[model samples]
Target: MAKVKHESRWYPLESGESVLDGLLRQGVSVPHSCRAGACQSCLMKAVGGAVPQAAQVGLKETLVAQGYFLACTCRPPEGTELEVAGAEALRVPARISSLSFLAPDVLRVRLVTDAPFDYRAGQYVSLVREDGLARSYSLASLPREDALELHVRVIPGGAMSGWLAAEAPLDQRVFLQGPAGSCFYVAGRPDQPLLLAGTGTGLAPLYGIVRDALEAGHTGPIWLFHGARTPAGLYLRDELRQLADRHPQLRYRPGVLAGGTRDIAEGPLDALIRAECPKPVGWRAWLCGDPQLVLSLRKKLFLAGLSLKDLHADSFLPSTPQVGASPAAAGAR
Candidate 1:
C-alpha cells in the first residue's frame, strides 16, 4: 500500500491510509477550505507515491503531472510514499482560539495552531463541526499572524455556526482544513488604485488584503466600498473607517444597496466611481460576497471601463458541504 504522510500536522494510523483517515485516527485537525476539488485549499503534493487523478479539482495541468494530489481524493499506489509538505501548504491544526460577538448575529473567532505558514490574503478555511459538517470561513489577518481570524455571521440554523455559538468556545478543538482556494490577493500587482468591494462577511479577506497592501508599502489610492442590505449587516464598518483615519490616501465608502431602486440610482456608487476616475481601465478590483452581488458588480465595473483581468473576485457558492454528487452537480462547466 502507498504511504501518505503530512508534514505540517503530526500523523498517526498506519501507512497507506487516506490523509483524512490518518488525521481522524490521531485526533489531529487540519483545515480544509473545500472538500470537493473545486477549491484548491485541500491540495497536497505527493513527493513520492502515485495518486489517482482527481479530474475535477481545477489543479493546473503542470501540477497534476508533477504529482500534486488532493488529500480528500487521492490514495497512494502500492509500496509508494507521499508527504503533504510545508505548514504553508497544509492547514494549521487548531481549535477555537477565541470567540467574541461582533454583532448580535456575527461572531468573530480566531483559530491558533503551532505551526508557521503563509498564504495570500483572501483565502479561506473549512471548519469541520463535531458532527462532520464543514463550512468555509475567510481569514481576516495578514500572512504573518500566528492566529487566523474569521468573521462568521451566525445563520439562524447554520449547522456549523450553531456549533460555534452553542457547544464550542475557548480552547475547544475541532477539525478543520485550509489555506485553500486560489482566489486571493496577487502580490506584485502593479501599483495603482485598489478597489475593495465586499458584502456581508466577505469583508474578512478584504481586510486582510488592505493590511497586507499597506505593509507591503503600496502608496496607491485605496478605495473600499461595502454594500449592505442594512447597516446592521455591515459587521466592521467602524473598523474600516478607523483604518481610513490614518491613511489619508485610503477611502472607505459604505452604502445600503437594498434600500430602493430609486435610492440605488441616487446612491449611484458605480457612477460615482466613473465620475471620479473617468478611465479606471488599469485599476485593480477585489470583490467578495454573495455571488449575485459580485456578478452584478463585475458586469457593471467592466461596462464602466475596467478590464476583466483587472478584476479579482471571490463569489460565494451557497452549499451544504455534502459528501457526494453526480458529475453535473459538481460545479464544473
Candidate 2:
C-alpha cells in the first residue's frame, strides 16, 4: 500500500488508489472537480517522490516542471508526499461591482479586484466562493478596464450562477484563480484576417478579444459570428452591432437555429460560416462554446485551410448546479 503525506498528516492509500481518493477517504478536505482531471481544480504539488507522468497529462509544461499534478489522477508510488498548492498565493481578491441579466438565463457580472489583475482579454479565471466552491469564467473585459467582466449563463439549478443571479450582493468578496487559456488577441498580427465565433454566453471572450484587437489598431478585417438556438439567447446584439457600425473593418453576424429575423442568419452556425468563408487560408480564428460544436468547427476550419497553429478554441462545459459541488462534477460552463 502506498502512503501520502500532506502538511503534518499522513494518509494510507488503498492499493491502486489515487492520491485524491486516499486523502478524501481519510477525511481530508481537498478541492476537486471533474475527477477525471479536466477541471484542474484538484491540482496538487508533489514535494517528495516522483509523480506519475499520467497524473500530469494535459497540464502546462511550467506546472509539470514545478511538480504540480492533479490529485485525482495521481497514483504515486509508496511514501509520496504532497501539498495543496497555496490557494491564497494563486487567488486574486475581488468584489462584485455589479450584476445584471444580459438574457433571461445569462448574467453579466462585473468584478473589481483589490489589486491589479493582469490578464489578457479572453483568458479565464475560477471564481471561488466563501465556502471554497469554485467555477471558471472567462474574462470579457480588457486589462485596462477598471472591472473584470464575465458573462455567466444561469443554468437550471446551477450553484454559482444561481448565487450570482439571485443571492450574491453588490460588493460581495470573491477570490479568483488563473487567467489561463490561450485564445486572446496578439498585437503583432495587425494585418492578419481574423474570424471570431461562438454561441450563447461564449460571446463573452469573443467580445473582449474583438475589442482588444481593435484597440491594438488591427488593420485587418475581422469577421465575428455569434449563434444561439433562439433570438432570446442572443444577447449583446445592439452592442455588437454598434461596435460594427463604428468599425468598417469589422463585420458582425448573428445567427439562430430558430426564430431567425430578417437581419439574423437562419441556419446552423457552422454552415453559415462555411458559406461565408469557404476557404479560410491564412486566417487567424478563435472559437468558443459547446465542446462538440467547437471541436467540429475546428476540424472543419482546419480542413478548409485554416492552420492549426493559428486556430484557438475554448470549450465551456455546462454549469454544475449543485451547491458545494465541484464545477467538473456538475459540468461548469
Q: Judged by TM-score, which candidate is best?
A: 2
lDDT of 1 at 221: 86
Model 2, position 37: C-alpha lDDT score = 61
TM-score of each: 0.71, 0.90
Instruction: Supply the TM-score for candidate 2.
Output: 0.90
Segments of candidate 2 deviating more than 4 angstroms: 14-17, 35-38, 53-66, 77-86, 319-331
Residue-level lDDT of model 2, residues 1-333, one tens digit each, is 677778777678887889877777777776655566655666777776777899998777877888888887888775554444434456789999999999999899999999999899998887888777777788899999999999998875677788888899999999887767788998887989999999988899999999999999998999999999999999999999999999999999999998889999999999999998888999999999888899999999999999999999898865433344454346355
| Candidate 2 all-Cα RMSD | 2.8
lDDT of 1 by residue, 176-209 (tens): 5556655565668547888888877778888998
Clashes of each: 9, 3
Model 1, backbone clash pairs (residues 3+ apart or across chains), number: 9
What lDDT score is found at residue 199 in candidate 1?
74
